[model samples]
Target chain A: MKTYLKLAAPMALAAALAPVPAAAAWRLVDQGETRKVARSTLVVTAPEEWNRATERPSSRSEVWTQDGIALSELTFYAKIKDGETLFKRRQGKRNPLPEFDKDMLPTDLVEWYEDTANIVLGGSLFEIVEVTPATLAGYPGVHLRYSYTGGDNVARLGEARVAIIDEKLYLISFEAPRLHYFDRYIAGVRAMMDNARFK
Target chain B: MKRLLASAALIGLFAQPLLAQETGDETPEEKPLPSAHGYEPQDDLEKGLWYEMDEAEKSLKESRFLIEEPALNAYVRSVLCQTVGDERCAATRLYLLRTPQFNASMAPNGVVLVYSGLLLRMRDEAQLAAVLGHEFTHFEKQHSLRIFRQIRTKTDLLSWRSVVPVRLPYPAGMATQLAVLGSVYDFNRDMEREADAGSIEELVRAGYDPRAASAIWSQLGAEMDATAEERGHRSDKNRNGGLFATHPRSTDRMGRLAYLAREAAGDGAGELYRGAEEYRAAIGPWWAQLIEDQIALKDFGGTEYLLATLAGDDPLGWTGDLLYARGELYRARAEDGDFAQAADFYRQAIATGEFPAESWRGLGLSLMRAGQKPEGQAALRSYLELRPEAPDAALLASMAGEAAS
Candidate 1:
């Protein structure tokens, strides 16, 4: 079923100016079972138990979180069509998310993430700590690590692995508070990435 | 507090010229100012307003987004002081914020926040002075106090005042405060006209080109038009419309200011300085950061217009950065044949021999997207060689291996 996720206020203003509840719905995903992610053309086994957001799914992406989205989030993207953004709601803003392109390089992807966080996530400060290439789902991909201070003045750390395969884009990303949440769950995220494979 | 008292003393010293002007003395040595120097809240109502603004100012001081560049800060302060006069300038404090919107605001308590976006758009010191003078007028005229009293009459001022300092992400608090300030104390057309006219007079008196005042608004209008065209919308509906529309349209403002400038110029001044070189030198170090902020907004149309404008001013000095920016823009736009265009620009940047290492990576990706695998692989190899420890290095190596086969 098609779902509509309405971000009632601008992302930049929502967290700091007005604390609006993220109108996302979730489902429980038990550990050790390979499950198909929403709308994506791939399936993966969870390393452990986690909560997956069922709201705001496109034909190519889904989100899971060990804690809440504000504290930590894991997102998956599969076969995102060219000219489509990873997040649906972001397509409406004055500075909307950049569209995905098959020809995008790792650097381009990094820029896309940066723009998304700054313009869509309402991050006041954003910096890319590092970017390196990696193999994703047995395909050439790039890994990006970044730090951003959001409008709420909370510092967050994020990491993403992205690849373009079969003329379509695929990505997995995780973000959490840099203080503790990032270190708390990064090993699990890495393990999940290690186990992930395209179906 | 000492600055305020000193301002009060200077008011009397300067009051004679103002009184003379009031009596219609043509070419008076000094113009009459609307508010005396060393202004303080006259009553509890004004005091309450200042209290709220003072808190907001404190938060602003602590804001992470404030650009802490000493040289840039000093340069901007010098311009503001030149326009407002050093004695009166002491009553105001300027905060250079790193926001990527073309906005500047002055709170009642002498806090002036200038966004980097405005700095990016400014062509010369005269333009910067014009904007500063306009904002200073807002403070000098006590517009915020007037608006606060009006809001107090209509709504509970205490509730509104409390909300101003809510912790919000990035610029959310600042944006909220600005939004609330705008909603409650929306400057009427007459106020804007006064500020605009006052700023022109200030520019002329400071020996700046009065014409530069009109040029800024005109350029802003043109940029908005370009943005509208790119977004397939009517010019009237452009996002920059709110601020520009709130004031007099650029055409009308430009016409009036040009007339005022002509009148001011009639006294036979040979030439007025725009201080273009001085302005560039002061802002040069921050250009890359400012440009990065603009591009991060992902407004292709606006970014392209801004880069083109800057490039037009100093093509040789800005060539490498301009070419790299253009390449990034085209790549981000990702339209048909854009990859080829991006590749071309990246190559041009690389040829400059002063390019950022990212240019090599960009060229590699652009070439690969354009279906020139061998050339693309070679370029990527060059990038890997240069920035071997880049976070995405392994990915590039993998891509190169794939291309080799």
Candidate 2:
């Protein structure tokens, strides 16, 4: 614990304490060049390693950058037989499933979507019908009235909510039953983001 | 994170199912990837380009062609060669693509490539290097090729499992060729273990902080858990489908790596080993392009992990901005967005200097929407000063100025 604190304090402080040189506020959302991906058709071919009856999550496909992994690839975990187990097959990759490559993002996004979808790795979208000034954690911020549902074709589950401050490019989002968690967790995300900063 | 680097020796243990085949002579799982730093084996060090040799090339050719782009091909190869020890390693190559699950590959050659998903989850350089070092071992010692040759030679035995047909030149002795491949694989497995032990050394030698390796795997486990809940499944093998977890897994992998990292960090203030800044400079163009593109995919765990990793690095300046962006990501989704938290990320970004002019504007907008006038007005004014000629400058000034008056 001391090692972590000793090492982490410095790094985290460096991360937390480095004076951020103010740069031009870059808007990733609403950018004309930023591809607005309306929808992505996810396709997962359940590997033989996963049990079919359990509604096992098979594979997943999404957009990613061509080289850098940050913008590409979504990993899956080993299959754990939770119930009356058939194969007792520990947890792992199947001999049949191919190894995951870093470059899969470009293929999954562009090749799969035929280069048509506007692909950004993170951030949610909302229309600013009316913008109300607000502060949550002692910092200047805003609250946007629910404008539009995120995407028409491939919205994940519920009423999508995103947090934005002009200075940053990353956003935290949640999609659930829309009724309960959205209101509750949106604040939690806000709290987490409040604690977020780069030195 | 530890098992992520499969030791060549462990391959044999895991590969007991394969090595036990009838007529098997050599263990393909035993072979290691060729040397990255040009370390000559005490006796068998005949250097040049052993990984891209005949049998290995055939295996490479047999696999599906995943990357067809000219630029990406070069980029992938460059990372494979320049990542570890002494660099210039051209034997291993990585290959996973367009698939949903996460995975990485260390080819029979010295080249290795990690999936972008793996990259996304890695919280820091240590984790990335740990995974890379594990693969680097495969190339440093000629394991992948050695193993492939071993498996290729014994067609009579391997034919039961391998679907790819072994087609050698008519005059050549197929049996002899297969034996060579199998022998290499057998030895390569040991090479893999050597690499695992070496992952810490290489990381230390390379000067990357090591504990992140374990941290990365822990995060991976978290991602899987969340995903499992979403899909309503017992388990989801690998992030995309099944790629990274090919070896035995345990919570211990992280602990073991952490213990090793402690030993690696050593006593004195370490001299800068590998030039991360130089690396960042070189990849600037790609990084710039990717950051915008990443959030669009909307994978929660991956993006979250990536942002945290970026934040984990002290010298790196974009963590706050990335967080600010994440706030927007969620807010936009309002469906999945934690708006209140998004508001907090904006604040953090501003406090950390992570936010530039845009963050102020974002804060102001969010604030105004939430009915916090004074704070929103101040932030918007800051945004205008930072970006006086912004596309919406007129509107922003009007809104801010009106509030001030």
Q: Largest lDDT belongs to which candidate?
A: 1
TM-score of chain A of each: 0.82, 0.24
Q: Of the candidates shown, which would achieve the greatest DockQ relative to the real structure? A: 1
Residue A81, model 1: Cα distance from true site in angstroms: 2.4
Model 2 RMSD in angstroms: 19.4
After superposition, candidate 1 runs with Cα above 4 Å error: A1-34, A39-41, A54-60, A90-93, A122-124, B1-38, B150-185, B236-242, B266-270, B313-318, B350-357, B381-394, B397-405
lDDT score at residue B29, model 2, on the 0-100 scale: 49
- Provide the global lDDT of candidate 2 against the true structure: 0.39
Model 1: per-residue Cα lDDT over B165-252, one tens digit each: 2111123323333322222223655667778888988988888887788777777777766766787655642221233433556467
Worst 10 residues of 2 chain B by lDDT: B165-174
Q: State each model's CA lDDT, in order.
A: 0.68, 0.39
Q: lDDT by residue for model 2 over B192-237, one digit each (tens)?
A: 3466667777666666665545565666666556545543554443
